[model samples]
Target: MKILLPVDGSECALRAVDHLIAHAAWYREVPEIHLLHVHPPIPIGRVQAHVGEDTLKAYYLEESQASLLAAQQKLDAAGRFHTTHIHVGQPAEIIAKMAKDLGCDLIVMGTHGRGAVAGLVMGSVANRLLHSAPCPVMLVR
Candidate 1:
């Protein structure tokens, strides 16, 4: 099975990883896990006025990579089979698109992310994903 797990470096996100680790053996075949971290888009006008586009892009990319690396370390320590993806966009949209593009059979992610206000207003990433995902989505609270 191809599984896409999106992490935002939150305890809730890590909980999803922990759940996956504990339940990995349930699948008949070893799953190919894709650990995804989506960096929010840089505000074009503000970024251009302060920092150049290249610098903004580089900063976002660097941060995304760091998040991915952190998640990778956790997965590695758990001895799970996986790869990492760092994207720049809305978290829910990017995760769903990635699942479609990667042919993922399932998307396992957290119900609540880092931001409390945004999650309350716009709903959580897992909530959005559950409504729009192409495949089965498992939400770890």
Candidate 2:
């Protein structure tokens, strides 16, 4: 099975990663893992205008790479072979899109575990992905 794992470097996100690592042995065949981090898009006009396109791109790359580091280290330590990706956009949208593009059979992600009221007001990425993702989504808090 191909699993798409999205990590934001939150304790919750790392929890999801840990869960997957522990359960990996349950599967008959080792699954292919795709690790992804989605950074919010650069502010519409100001940051891009000030930094220039190339510099803005560099900034996005740096931040996203940093966000992925903890998860990457854990995977490395476990000797798990996987591919990593970074994108700038709405996290839910990017995650759903990436799963489809990569032909992932399942999506395993972490949730921030907001209260229902807070989630309804601020919205939840995991909730959005549940509706938008083409494949099954497993959310770990």
Candidate 3:
């Protein structure tokens, strides 16, 4: 099975990674794992023109790397083989799309564990992915 793990550098997100690593043996075989970090688009319209494409790309790389670092280290320490990807867009949409494109069997991610009202007001990506992901989504708190 293929699993898509999304990391956002939050402790909650790391918890999700830990949960996956802990339960990895539940699968029949060691699953193929893919780590994804989605950078939200900068709202500045003309900022790209001022910053240049290369600079923006570098920013994305730097931020994504920071967000992915701990998760990567955890997987590495667990001796779990995996691949990493970085993208810019809405997190939920990007995550769901990546799962479909990679033909992943499951998507594992972390949740902030907000109350129902807060989740609705804040627009939880976990909640959104639950509805839109092509594959099953497992949320760890």
Q: Tell me how candidate 1 scores on lDDT.
A: 0.84
The TM-score, computed over Cα atoms with residue i paired to residue i, of candidate 3 is: 0.92
How would you encode candidate 1's per-residue C-alpha lDDT over 1-141 as one tens digit per residue?
A: 999999888887888898998999889999999999999886687658879878887898788787667668878998886888888898889999999999999998878877444565434777778888999998887
Per-residue CA lDDT of candidate 2, range 43-112, in tens? 7777655678888888889988888898899988998888999898988899999999999999988876
- Scored by CA lDDT, what does every candidate get? 0.84, 0.85, 0.88
- Model 2 scores worst on lDDT over the 10 consecutive residues at 113-122
Clashing pairs for predicted structure model 2, backbone only? none
Best by TM-score: 3
Model 3 lDDT at residue 12: 83
Q: Candidate 3: global Cα-lDDT?
A: 0.88
TM-score of each: 0.90, 0.91, 0.92
Best by lDDT: 3
